[model samples]
Target: MPPAVRERISAVTQKGVTLKDVAAAAQVSRATAARALNSYGYVGGETARRVLEAADRLGYRGNRIAEALRRGQLPLVGFVPGDIQNPFFARIAHDLEVELRKQRHNLLIASSEEDVEQEKELLDSLRSLSIRGFIVAPASATDNRHIAELAVGNVPLVLVDRAVKDVQCDSVVVDNEGGAREAVDYLVANGHRRIALLRDDSRIFTAQERLAGYQNSLREHGIALDESLVSISRSTVEHAVEATIRQFSRRDRPTALFTVDSLMTQGALLALRSMGLSIPHDVSLVGFDDFNLATFTDPQITVVAQPISEIGPLAAKLLLDRLAGNRPAIRNIRFPTRLVVRGSVLHPRKS
Candidate 1:
């Protein structure tokens, strides 16, 4: 390290640098130094620059909590997603962090783990931090009073990948119902009557919409809804494996399996393999939210592909717009999903 830099750091550690010292160095008043450092009231361009330089030189580390309290908000945007381990949310997080940082704001991410109580708790905790805003993929579609309260309280918030019933706010999601319907329609078109669905909890908005699509598609084709063929599991591989096993243990097993998310799809693949079932022969498969493993699998999985790359960046933009005080009206953008066909399906007789 350079000599001056080392000396400045040592001075801070030994005696602690004060705002007065920084003000004296910059030839400004203490009030001006505070303003420049905390970013509350405006300061002149040249004076603000000098004050920041002097603060850096003296290694003056202000109390962040105190500053946030004074300013009524922090330079941070909290993100609460359904699951952090899911790559769909991971990609969105990366984009959110990048975009927030561009505006001199930091990202604070907390996963709700697909639990309504946890989602409520996380939002409460983040609000206590005086977070400038939030971007969330809520855990429940119906039980979302915590999220609704935030919107009603005029908190700057954006919902991504899901929207609640009464919480009106800016959102960025996809046509989950349409995508799911298409996947099932394709399966039915290929002459498959005994198709099964592996899905997430009913509370989640995406799961609800996708489930509707599944039911609607079957009904449109004059096929009766067999409640036995639908299995519910958490959005995790282990839970999905268990669900898949239970679903297939019946003597009249499903001819095809449609999994809602990539994690569940991966679990289904494992469970099927463990049972000595072969793809496109023993049981054809389709999944939602394509992942790296989707294309790599043998007879690469057919999937309802959401515009993953578009979702995160678009959500970030919407949240940023809200933070920028440009709220003419609430914007709710829902992108369309497409079916990405591969070699994962076969005729009913083959199954």
Candidate 2:
């Protein structure tokens, strides 16, 4: 190669590949390369193919930040969950990313750790980056001032899994009350009179609904509500285990247990194992959020399964539609839950 040509090539490589380099390599003008790569104006099929091949060979990537700025918008979306450690939230983030990518948008994920202040900080940081939209599961139901402000600002927002009260925006959630009711009703029908409810604190909307459903089911079955049997404010596995042990240590122990979430269910199982009790043979069990571990458990836990796969895609679609200028009234979509009957529950044993 000529020394001048070699120096030009080295300069292009050292400065990082650009659209101009791609256009030169393809023997096309810079505007033609830009139209082909961005799919903006019409370009001949042969020209477009050559431009794309040259771009690939030169490792040329368009500057998304500059393009977004030119359009006066960001090519980014955000998903703020309380805890990404939970399998359900992990699945939501994954599915939402898949959907967002289909629309040529990127997903920015952040965990709030179920802290109100942390969630607020995350939202502020994401907003500073010019995030186009957000799919948030409020960290605390009571403290959603930031979320409310987003709605008031007419930001494209969707609340998933858990929603804040009185914030009118698109939301996707499961039928928590109905699912909890069905789980308790199934236990009651199995002849379990003394049933215990294990769940997190009522500061979360889902927990409050599940607790309400448990109480409603007991009342419907003509069983007196026992406050002691309902364990509230338990978030960690240790807290759940302690609550379970305390309940089972009582003189009139529960014959069956209903846990409102996956962590609590696992904690209850651990507590039972520690006590050397067998499923159904000693105390029956039912739980919410069916997971892979549930099917692998000794008795195969019966659970209320949320449609996690559907929730993420639906929420993304709602936000995308809003961004596309399809502004109907705000919608709150509630997905149905199913009760999978496994071998976890049995008839109450005679004392």
For residues 1-351, what per-residue lDDT tens digits would candidate 1 score against the true structure? 457555555666568788877777777899999999988799999999989988887778888767775566668889999999999999999988888888888899999999889889899988887888899999988888899999988788899999888788989999999999999999999888889999999989999999999999999999999999999998889999999999999999999999999999999999999999899888999999999998898989999999988888888888888788887688889999999999999887752
lDDT of 2 by residue, 246-284 (tens): 878887888999999888888899998898878988899
Total colliding residue pairs, candidate 2:
0
The per-prediction tally of clashing pairs is: 0, 0
Show model 2 residue runs off by greater than 4 Å. 1-72
Top candidate on TM-score is: 1
Please tell me which predicted candidate would have the highest lDDT against the true structure. 1
lDDT of 2 at 159: 96
Q: Name the weakest run of 10 consecutive residues (lDDT summed) in model 2.
A: 1-10
List lDDT for all candidates, in order: 0.89, 0.89
